[model samples]
Target: DIAHQNKREIYNLLMRASADAVIRIAADPKHLGARVGVTSVLHTWGSAMTHHPHVHMIVPGGGLSEDGTKWIACRKNFFLSVRVLSRLYRRLILDGLSRLHKAGKLRFFGDHAKLADLAVFDAFLQPLRKIDWVVYAKEPFAGPKAVLAYLSRYTHRVAISNSRLIRVDDRGVTFRVKDYRITGPGRHTTMTLKTDEFIRRFLIHVLPKGQHRIRHYGFFGNGNRTANIARIRELLGAETPVPGLAHDNTIEDADAPARVLALPCPCCGGRLIIVDTFAPAQHPRAPPASARAAA
Candidate 1:
């Protein structure tokens, strides 16, 4: 799985696009010398958790100035423009794919045999050029707390949440379907599937082990994240972050992260210690179960 060059190449191209896009944006006088971090997480599923591959990126609002002199604060209400970002992202990725095709690095499958031909490939991409690629940019979180809570969900994740797999009946397996509209975005609505189909759909999201779907990039590149972050703060003329602020941006900054896990306790901004938890069978047992009882 990881041995496939196409997957690796595609992954690289996506990373490059994010980095390049940031560079393009930074080059603009508006952005100054933005030293923003980009963290991209690979997700190969759609609302039904089907094999609809895409990446999610987390990005800070501003970056270091070009000269690393001042922090280039982004507009309070926005990140890069979704329309423009999408166009740039799509062009970079499609161009990479086209290059691979021309270099004989990409392969056409059984029915895609025509794609093996350069002319056919060119024709195939013709429509893509006309289509506005799906680059969505949701409003940045309300506050820093929201950002941390959001990152926790994707910093690590699984293909399916337990609440979704309702049952494994003959008629089909039952799970939740999310009506992003009605549920007011990132909310789940229920749906079902045949047992086999359920497995198939779920399997599509299974990443090859060791191939990390979650990744960090740019100022958060790990090598000199501290320095880059410092440069960014300097550029924006901001105070050194006290703590819990997001300097880590991502590959898929378009959509918001899924909120499967709980957020830090709002009542107490400080750490909320978890004393213990009960097992499924023992959960909510008796009239009033206590933490000690579960232990």
Candidate 2:
């Protein structure tokens, strides 16, 4: 239950981290009073392709002044220091989680059941302090075009691509998992998993109903997005996308299920047989075969 709870939306913790990040980044006088525009994309993948949830924030290093008069930009390559961001992020997340526990908003189950007691909860969260929760920063995508390319690959991706699955049979399914195998001379390897187990592992990542897995915060808050965009435009004093400059890329991979067969369908734990699959580029609106559309 704790695992489920942890994976589900922790809105308060998310917001707290966002706020702290914006505060730290914006408070620096070196920004020369530039505004901030950031879109935080929630991602839950590590090198192992496991459910290590984290955020990939797309931010313009600098923004227009609040008055929409001058454009500002950060240094060419650096965003805030990852070390600082990690420390701040962990603290803010923990503090918010603690607040939720105190307010009786957090639910505990399994071995976590004892967390109902304040002392027990404190002890449980204590170890979190010792472990440095991972915070990584890839060099910002090149320019607007590069940023778009990067997002195209991740934004709508499902738990696992159908191409990764070799086959699904009654004798435990078999599917390919990423082989982070190093290349030395002619050495290469790919990992595979059994079907039932694959579905089980994939199911672990299925988010709850109506949970906005990816969200934006700070100056990029949805409510203020339009006005903010206009403000930013004015600050930049840069011409908008040239008339013919506007272009789009659309790719259609062979239809396949974005998830592996290992995860069971919530409705009956039935195997989610692939009727079709769509690539990240062409994310078609569709419902999960295993469950009703989340309201």
Q: Per-residue alpha-carbon lDDT of model 1 for 128-246, expressed as tens digits?
A: 88888777777888887797677666655566777567777668877777765665555766778777777877776655556776667767888888888776655556688545343
- What lDDT does model 1 reach? 0.67
RMSD of 1: 9.8
lDDT of every predicted structure (CA atoms):
0.67, 0.64
Candidate 2 lDDT tens digits, 1-295: 4535665537436744865676565656653355576666665554334665656677777665656676667677876666666777888887777887788877877777888898888898899977886666677676776776666566766767766656666666554544446566434334456665666667766676677756766567799887777667765665555433223422334675432224334433334456577888997866655655554
How do all models score by TM-score? 0.72, 0.71
> How does model 1 score by TM-score?
0.72
In terms of lDDT, the poorest run of 10 residues in model 1 is 244-253
